[model samples]
Target: MPNALSESRACLPPPHPPEVAKGVILDARHALVHAEQGWMAIADVHFGYEARRRRAGALLPDWGMPQCERVLHELVRDHQPKRLILVGDIMDGSGTVEETLELLKRLTESVKIICVLGNHDRAGLKRGMSMIPSHREGEFLFEHGHLPLSDHEGVIVTGHEHPATHFRDGAGLRLKLPTMVQEQISAKTQRWILPAFSPWAAGGEYTSEHKRLQTWACGKGRVWRV
Candidate 1:
C-alpha cells in the first residue's frame, strides 16, 4: 500500500525551468499571481468539479469548466508563462486522466505543467507527473502538505491547506479572500505556498485546527489576502 507521503509526493511533475524561481510574472486579479516559469500560482482550480459532483449524483452548478479555463487562459496570455506549477489538487476528485490530458493539452501549447498533487488527486489517475522530475531542489521538499514535513535544509512549498481568509464588519458581513503564503526555506532557502487555483474547489480554511501550522511559524509566512 502506498503511504500518504508517497502519494502526495507523486503529484509533482518535473520542474520545467532550470531556475526554480524568477521568470515572467502576472498578478491575476483573482487574488493570485503567475510566473513565466510556466507556473500559474493560483489556488483550487478543481477542474472537472461539476462533472465529478454530478457523477456522484450531487446536483450543483455546472460552472467550473468555462470559468476555470478562462481564468487559466487569461493568466497564461497575460503572463506568457512557460510552465504551470499547480500547488495541489488540480482536479476535484478522482479525475480522469483522459479529460485531464485533453484539458492540459489545450492549456499547454509550448509550456510545461507541474502539479504538486493534492489530497484530492487520487493515485490511480495520476499520469502526467512522470513527465517532470519530482523533488527539484536538493532536500527541497515539495508536497501537498497533507502530512508533516521532516526537518530539512532547503525550501519547502506545497498546497493542501487551500488557505483562504475572510474579513467581516462588526455586523458580521463576511468577505471572502484569496491568500498567498510565503515562508523561508531555511536560512537561505525561500518557500511559497500558493492558494488553490481552481475556482470551484473547496479548501481547508486557514484557521482550521487541521491546517499546517509549521510552515507559518518561521516568521516568513506572509498572507496576501486578495
Candidate 2:
C-alpha cells in the first residue's frame, strides 16, 4: 500500500539530481539519468511490438509505439541531456522496421543517441544502425544484461531483465508493475536493473539468489520505492 507522502512525492516533477545511487537519478519516466555525465538512458523500448503482433493475427491495436514516442519526447524535452542511451532491445524484429528508423531519426535530431546492442537489436543492425558493446563513464558501466559481465570497478547498469514486482490491494486486485532494482553484489560492486520502457513488455520477476535487493515499483507515471 502507498502512503499519502509517497503518492504526493511521486506526483512532483523529477528532481534535478535526485541521487538514487552515487551518481544515478531514477526518474519517474522509468528511465535513469547519469547526473554527472549528462546522459539519460532507457531500456527495452521494444518498438513495433503492436505491429508485429497484428501481422501474426494477434488483433492488437496501434497504441504502444505512439505512447512510447510521446513519453520519450517528453523526457528529451524536460531534461535536454547531452545524449540518450538506448540500453538495449530497441526493436522487436518481427516487423515495422521503417517506423523504428523514423523515430530514431527524430530523436537524433535533438540529442545524440548511443545504442547498446541487445539480443533483439540485430534487426536494427541489419538496417544500418550504429551500436556499441557497452558504454562507460566515470563510474557507471551501461550494458544489456544478456551475457556475463566482466569485472569492473564501479556501478553496473543493465536493462535486459525488465524487472517487475506484483502487488495486491485491499480490494484483492492484483497489480503487476515494472520495477527498478538496486542490487548490492558486494561492498564494492553495485548494479542497477531498470524496468522496460515499453508498456507491452512482459517483465521478468527480479529476484536475488542470495538475498533481497532494494526495489521500486512504477505505476501511473509515479514511482514508489519499496
Candidate 3:
C-alpha cells in the first residue's frame, strides 16, 4: 500500500494548461475560466446525507445545511462565478426536502444553479427539478461518476469517492485527509474525482487496493490533499 502523501501526489491528473481557453483549472473539482458564462462546476453535494442516516436511527449529528452553506458561500465569494454546476447528489434522500429548499433559496441570489441527478437521488426527491445525466462545457464533460460513459473524448469530471488519504504521524497516529484525484481517462480524455465538500460525510481510503478505485480509473492518478 502507498503512503498517504505519496498516494495523494500520485493521483493528481496532469495539470491543465495555464490557460484552458479562457478559464483556469481551480483545484481538481472545477474550472474557473473566463468565458461568456464565467462559471464554476462542482459535483456531489449529497446534501442531507446525515439526516437520511439519522432517520435510519444512525444517530448522526445535525450538520447538514450549515456545512453545505459554508462551502457554497466560500466558493461563490472566492471565485465569483456567475454559474454553479452541481454535478449530482444534491440531496441525500427525499426526507430532507426543507433543508434542500432552504439551501437552494440561499444560493439563488448569488449565482445560477445547475444540478444533475446521482444514482442515490430518487424520482420523488427530484419531482420538479431539472436534473440531467451529463453536462458539457466546451470540450469538458461533467457527471456524478456513478455511471459509465461509452467514450472519453474530453475532460471528464465527477465526484463519488468522497476520497481521503490516511497518513500516520511520528507518534503512529493515523489521520485521514480529504483529497481530490486527477488522471487521464484515455489518450484523449482526462478524469478528476473531487473530494466531498460536505463536512458530515465519510470517504474511502485512497491507498486501499480496492476494485472501486480501479473501476473509476483511479489507479495511478494524482491526489490533492484538501
Candidate 4:
C-alpha cells in the first residue's frame, strides 16, 4: 500500500523554490500556483522596463528578457500549471505595446496566459490583460493593487505594490527578496498581495504594520514566513 507521503505528494513536484501555505503555492521562483485549480500566476513583470528607462536617460543594464525567460521557464517546468495568470504591471509606463507583446511571445508554451491590467499598463494595448482591470474566478479575484477592492468581494489576490524586503544572511550580508503579503480583513474576507515576478521590480516594501498580515519571503531558493 502507498504511504500517505507518496499518495499526497505524488502530485507535488519537488521541495524547491515554490512552497505551499494557506492554500497558495508560492511557485519557487517568482510565481504562484493554486494546485487544486492548476492555475499558476506571476505579477509585475514590467517587461522592457530597463529599455524604457534607458530611453529616458537612465543608464541601466539590459537584463530583462533573460531573467524573465529563466524564471518563467523554471516555474512552467516545475509546476506545469494549466493557466499562467499575470496579475498586473506587465509593462512599465515607458514600454511600448509592441515591446510588451513581443516579449510575452516567448513564455510557457500552450498555457493560457491571463493578464490583469495595472496602472502602468495604460499603453493602450488592445488584447488580453491590456484591456482588463481585474479577473474573477469563482470566489477568487485577481487584480492590480492600484485601486481599492470593491466591498462585495471575498478573497482577493493582487499585485502592484511590488512588495519586497531586505533579508540578512548568516554572514551579515543583506539581500532583497520578493515577498507575498497575506492580510486578513475579517472573519470571512482575505487578501493576498503577490510579489513582483520581475527582478527589476525589487526595492518595494510595505513598512507600515498590519496586524493580520503574514508574509512569506522568497530568498536563497526558498519561501519562508517572515
Which candidate leads the pack in lDDT? 2
Which wins on lDDT, candidate 2 or candidate 4?
2
lDDT of each: 0.54, 0.82, 0.64, 0.74
Q: Quote the positional error of residue 119 for candidate 1 in Å.
A: 2.5
* Residue 187 in model 4: lDDT: 68
State the TM-score for model 4: 0.82
lDDT digits (tens) for residues 1-226 of candidate 2: 9999999987774434346766667777788986568999999998999988888899998999999999999998887889899988888775667777888988998989998988787664545678887998778888988988647778788898888888778898987889888887766777888899998986978776534467877777666676
What's each prediction's TM-score? Answer: 0.66, 0.87, 0.73, 0.82
lDDT tens per residue, model 3, 123-180:
7656656778888777767788887853768767787767666667789897665555
Ranking, lDDT, top scorer first: 2, 4, 3, 1
Candidate 4, 1-226: lDDT as tens digits: 9999889877544456545455667755767777777788788888778888898899999888567867787777788888788888887775566677766676635567777878878655555334577777666788887897756457788887878877677898988888888887666777888888888877577754445568888875767777
Off by over 4 Å in 3: 1-37, 207-226
lDDT of 1 at 182: 57
Q: Global CA lDDT of candidate 1, please?
A: 0.54
For residue 114, model 2's alpha carbon misses the true position, in angstroms, by: 0.2
Scored by Cα lDDT, where does model 4 land? 0.74
Q: How many clashes does the backbone of model 4 have?
A: 2
Superior candidate under lDDT, 2 versus 3: 2
lDDT tens per residue, model 1, 1-226: 9999999876543223222234422243332332422344554566788887788899988777777787677767776665566656666777455565567778777456666666666664476544322334334456666666546666566666665555579797975555445556356555556556666643444653233323211111222223
